[model samples]
Target chain A: MMKIVTRNLITYATLLLAYTLLFRFGLSSLLTAEKWIWVKVIAVIYGAMIFVTAWMTGRRDGKENFLFDAGFRWNLTTGIVWGLVSEGWFLLGLHSNYESIRMIHIPLLIWSGFLVLHFSLFLILKRRTIGGVHKTDIFE
Target chain B: MTTNDTFHEDLLGAWEETYKKGQLTLWIFLSLKEGPKYVTQLQESIALFSKGTIRAEEQSLYRTLRKFYHLKMVDFSSGKGHKGPDRKYYHLTPLGQSLLQSFVERNILLFFEEPLKDLLLS
Candidate 1:
């Protein structure tokens, strides 16, 4: 658990640093001309990173037990972080009167949908009592 | 290498892999049978008891413990760590002890029989 948490903290920190560099250096200007294409690309990349990290963490632990739960938790954490960051960016754009930044909502909406699905699958699997050590549970 | 040597190597490797995988659960139970242990202690005990034959990873041990906890085969209490936060010290429940006892009687003790002992030695 500490290992996973530490790994995730490092990942999130790296991600934040990378995003800051991209935006502060030149990505913000590029976003205007590209009509939020960079934003979409970044969103996709972030989603993939979150998924791969969670999946790897689960596989390392024991997929039969921790896979979906890991994915769910990762998704939940990243989803909130993504939502907050995007909302902040959008609010900043509004204050500065940048029309193109409003499109950030597209990725946020899509991510929220996937997050809901991930959460629902987690709940379903827990209710069904599938996977984990219960796979061979005789007491049940 | 000769074809025969290669084949033998592969076969032995596969057998060892399967054997280790199967024995992990038993070793885990035996480790807990000694006393309640945290994950690191459990890993150390298993390696020591198995004479370095089995070395379980932290994640795998946590996964097994989580399963046991869910199954009510094990219970844990929070205890202070050496320099870190609290740790969960897991101990076998009554059900787990009974199961281990029954398992030893039905399966493990068979190897101690005269014929099986000779076969194993041979």
Candidate 2:
């Protein structure tokens, strides 16, 4: 479990780092005048990709149990959360002399909140369904 | 040359083409025939089974498993522990077993087995 969490954390952190770098360096130059519009456009596109990918990937399962499909659910949620954090930081506080580093706090909070909610909900649900340690579960 | 160098080249060449078409999915299911495996274990077994010719990326492998679970061809349950997230151990369903059997029969096991042997031996 630690291993999986570590891998997920590393992945999420890396993605967060990459996006932060891009937003700070790349976007600063490209959209000096009307940066907010470009950010909104990118957020919308990112959100769309997330939804489309989730829908297509889970198309095989039909409606039943599709929501529980971890890959689709995780990706879609991650995309939505990420899109919000990525765009929200700038939107919430975009002073002409804003320090980009200060923007990290909100995204970090959102990421942590997401990880907490997702894992807690999943663990609770799994405990209810499987019950405690039992012999049949082990061998079968 | 070392085995690693030989296989790394193969990864960039023939394997990439095959993988793009989802041939790796068979190898994944095939590896689970003996018993259930966690995702990391499954990845290791597949690479060892193929003698380093194929190494599945984590995202793709998990996505495939979820797809299989949705199709009812496979299922998973958590391993014993109260640690972080449960370690999901995946096993084939009866449906998955039949599907794998038919796949092997149609392709002739040699189609996969022979190439792997020839790659390692030669």
lDDT of 2 by residue, A1-140 (tens): 01222333344444554554455444554455657777667656545654554455345332222233234245434645555655665676543343364555666667677767776776565553322222122111
DockQ values for all predictions?
Answer: 0.13, 0.02
User: Judged by lDDT against the true structure, how good is candidate 1?
Assistant: 0.70
Estimated TM-score for each candidate: 0.58, 0.40
**Residue A120 displacement in candidate 1 (angstroms):** 2.0
lDDT of 1 at A103: 58
* Candidate 1: RMSD to truth: 6.3
- Candidate 1 chain A: worst 10 consecutive residues by lDDT? A131-140
Off by over 4 Å in 1: A1-27, A32-70, A94-102, A127-140, B1-6, B34-91, B102-122
Model 2 chain B: worst 10 consecutive residues (lDDT sum): B15-24
Tens digits of lDDT, candidate 1, A1-140:
21335454445545754554454334456555665777677657755765666566545444443333525665666656655665665566532334355456786788889988887887766654543323443221
lDDT of 2 by residue, B21-119 (tens): 656767887889979998888999989998987778887677667657756778998896456677999999998899889978887566557776688
- Cα lDDT computed for each candidate against the true fold: 0.70, 0.61
Candidate maximizing DockQ:
1
Q: Mind giving the per-residue lDDT tens digits that candidate 1 earns over B33-62?
A: 999999999999999998998989998788
